[model samples]
Target: MSLRRRMCTVAAGAAAAPFVLVMLPAGVANAHGYVSDPPSRQAQCADGTVECGPIQWEPQSVEGPKGLDMCSGGNARFAELDNDHHGWEVTDVASTVEFSWTKTAAHSTRDWQYFIDGDLVAEFDGGNEQPPFSVDHTVDLSDYSGEHTVLAVWNIADTANAFYACTDVNIT
Candidate 1:
């Protein structure tokens, strides 16, 4: 190509660089949601309440296959969440705890499941519809007491993936 043509090409590329950079994140917005209230492990990390790894940067991205029973959702990048002795803050609560979730990229949901000690405590129907930006579920924990880890799962309706978060709590 001629020198003039090369210069024109470079100028055009430079002009579009900013726009390209801005739109780059649009394609990586697949990150969905995570528990924010009662502060799930990922939530604590994201908010700096607890020191964690990459999960601190993208808490809403702890997504993996549905029916998972772990906090990190089987995502190796967030494996720190699976560590139970990582000085995670335990929220003190009564027999009932209302867990709240923040959805960054709201997708259709199949259901929301809460488990403790690997036992299902509550399950809410999502009706295969998109949820609100913030979702809340008042779970009854009257059957159990003392320190416990609550695993909350947001099962996406259309996909086989689910978002997972573990909340440490002292039930009084």
Candidate 2:
């Protein structure tokens, strides 16, 4: 095309760039995560088994300050996971169980820990690099019996925070 027309086309493209950027969502908005396997309390809500608030939309985002025992990851918005009367769905498994997590934003992992009735059952080093989009860990549960709650924590290497999930299960 002619030089003038070409210049006009370039100017139009430049003017539209800002609009395109504005239409896209922010990156920070997608930086949280949650567990799904065995169905965390928030995951139960995400799957429509239980009615919950905003956590139903972001089940993997139960993030909070590390070292806290709260199940909602210390965020009051997701505190529903901490409640025992929500009638959360339970899973039945053998002496061993598999724990999994879905990572939306791969932050450097510090460690992955599992607890049963407030006692540490399993733990693994998360390394200093970002984990895969999905992670699965096999934990030995031969020592426990009957039913119990499993609280899994994914600690971030670069932050004093962690992602939390709780799953109720019956051992066979």
Best by lDDT: 1
- Give lDDT: candidate 1, residue 130: 79
Residues 30-138, candidate 2, lDDT per residue (tens digit)? 3467778878888899989999889989887898988877788889998788998888888898889988887788888889999988889999998777788899999
Clash pairs (backbone) in predicted model 1: none
How many residue pairs clash in each candidate at the backbone level?
Answer: 0, 2
Question: What tens-digit string does per-residue lDDT give for candidate 1 at 55-157?
Answer: 9889899999998898989999999999999999999999999999998888888999999999999999999887888999999999999999999999988
**Stretch of 10 with least lDDT, candidate 2:** 26-35
Residue 14 local lDDT, model 1? 100
Give me candidate 2's TM-score against the actual structure.
0.83
| Clash list (residue pairs), candidate 2 | 33-60, 34-60
